[model samples]
Target: MDTTQTGLPVRRGPRPRATTTNPHVQLDQNAPAELQDRLRDHALSLPGVRRGVSTVSVPGTVAFFLDTPTERPAVPDILGGEWGHIHPHTDGSLHLHVPSTLADDLIAAGWAEYHSLVSRGILPPIVIMLYGPRDEAELAVCSSIVEEAYLAAGGSRVDRAGRTLGLPTP
Candidate 1:
């Protein structure tokens, strides 16, 4: 294993594909442009949020940073992930960490469902997903739900400097 200066092992091998079962199925990318733009802008606008490489079952995937600027964000225990993220998929669905109540609410409302990874425990149970919205109204609601994930991760402008400086924030 290749170790970093911090002595943490770096992941270097055949990368795992975020998508497989649906590899043959293509999601509508031409649509949801507006929703994607909104998510990108909102996530980037955060004080310390930075876009990371893809880690999900879609194209144009990006992770939202939280808690530790140098390390990836972990889902708050309340959200059921020891460490997790806000993963937005190109298909307009999000593989993000969220609380059970929120997940249940969305699922009951038919707004979201669990990602396959969540089932195998490869991802936290909170990694709920919502398929691409069919209209602007649904898109708007989806955007807000993603924002809730960021908040649950303790992502906030006030905590930016603290995380970046290696000081406790949450």
Candidate 2:
């Protein structure tokens, strides 16, 4: 795992694999239902965030979107203000749009990977698959990651640990 002084710590294990077709689910190392609920609640609690079905993911996932988006979003052209979504009771993985630079760091740190469509140019590089949190410690990191994604989506909130990320301009 790699680290950047002011970025997310390297997640503690190998990257999890995600399916390549419809549904695009995580294949292993899923989070428990309780932790998934906690993470969902945390994302929804961000300022201006709202819960809804994902516009870009399979049905049954819960998505987080801003009620009002910033003028310039880090990832543009998302449907219905959608910024991120979680596979709650299923794989528990999440899909989000983050600042491009942060997406690279997240991959380098083993916390996430670019969404498959990004490589095919169907999606921008900002779109990523954030791996699920398997324990309390991992949940803390996942939560912070989700917050960063939220900020990138035009929502405002203070940094959790005084850790300033390269947040997308609002």
Candidate 3:
């Protein structure tokens, strides 16, 4: 191992590929292909959101995570999400975060439920793993949920995606 400028040891071997246990390997969530494409397209179009690349990403999962520099949020509050993001997996389910109010509302409406693993360590309690957008209409609802999460993460959705757009001048 060699120490890098950041004072972390670096491995000097062929890098390994991403791996996953994939508990849902046999469970396809039944969302259509178009919906999956739409979700990916929309997420990349949002400001400061991008295709996720991490040390550990689940195999066969398409993730769009927030890339904005933001202040961490205080729970029971909705104004900011420190690192909000979403993963629309092959199983047709969703894993994401939204402000607590929206999360509660989604749970009430039967659109989603909490992922018990969120708070063990990986994500904050405010982040929940959503389940089931089993159809087109449900996918639309899913889009809105994603929009809210992205917004909470301090992302904007102008056509430029990641660029800052100046106000029109006189």
Candidate 4:
């Protein structure tokens, strides 16, 4: 397994190819249905997150957004509500707005690539598509990545175990 400079291990095998990142779909190496379900469940389970149909993504994509206002939402305007969403296609990939530095790291680590809109200057580079987890280990890594997105949203600080340390007192 190839690990990133930050120690996030990239999944084994060829990097999944993208047929069109604008619609944000993958061409091959899609995760199986079970893994896809598990990944989506894990992402939706993050603190302050809620699931709904994506207003920003392609039709049928399930969206994850902060249900409550964050103390300091970093990218609060993502499609007016969503901060991330899971694609409905077979690849099961997801697009999310994370911290810019982390986004660069994720791309460098081969875990993700910038959204097509970023290239055209329509969206900031913070938007990325984290490839779907291919197995158990990748699932864990992807979960961690989602947690980072949660943090970037100013949801709350959390431990590596995903426990809320407590929200800041207003």
Q: Is candidate 1 or candidate 4 better by TM-score?
A: 4
**Lowest lDDT 10-mer window, candidate 3?**
17-26
Residue 11, model 1, lDDT: 31
Relative to the unseen true structure, what is the C-alpha lDDT of residue 99 in candidate 2, on a scale of 0 to 100?
Answer: 87
Q: By summed lDDT, which 10 consecutive residues of candidate 1 come out lowest? A: 161-170
Across 46-153, the per-residue lDDT of candidate 3 in tens digits comes to 666666542223565656656453434323332232333334345555556667766666555555555554435544556555553545655655666666666656
In lDDT terms, how accurate is model 4?
0.76
Task: Record all residue pairs in model 2 with backbone atoms less than 3 Å apart, i.e. clashing.
Answer: none
Q: What TM-score do all the candidates reach, one by one?
A: 0.59, 0.86, 0.60, 0.85
Q: Write the per-residue lDDT of candidate 4 for residues 1-170, one digit (tens) a residue.
A: 66665666656766789855468677677777778888788777766778898987678788888767555876656676688888875668888888888788788778888887888888898899888887888877787787677667766676547676421222
Clashing pairs in model 4, backbone N/Cα/C closer than 3 A: none
Off by over 4 Å in 1: 1-31, 56-59, 67-74, 77-90, 157-170
Alpha carbon lDDT of each predicted model: 0.50, 0.80, 0.50, 0.76
What are the candidates' C-alpha RMSDs?
14.1, 3.7, 16.1, 4.5
Candidate 4 local lDDT, residue 36: 81
The alpha-carbon deviation from the true structure for residue 81 of candidate 4, after best TM-score superposition, in angstroms, is 2.4
What would you estimate as the lDDT of candidate 2? Answer: 0.80
TM-score attained by model 4: 0.85
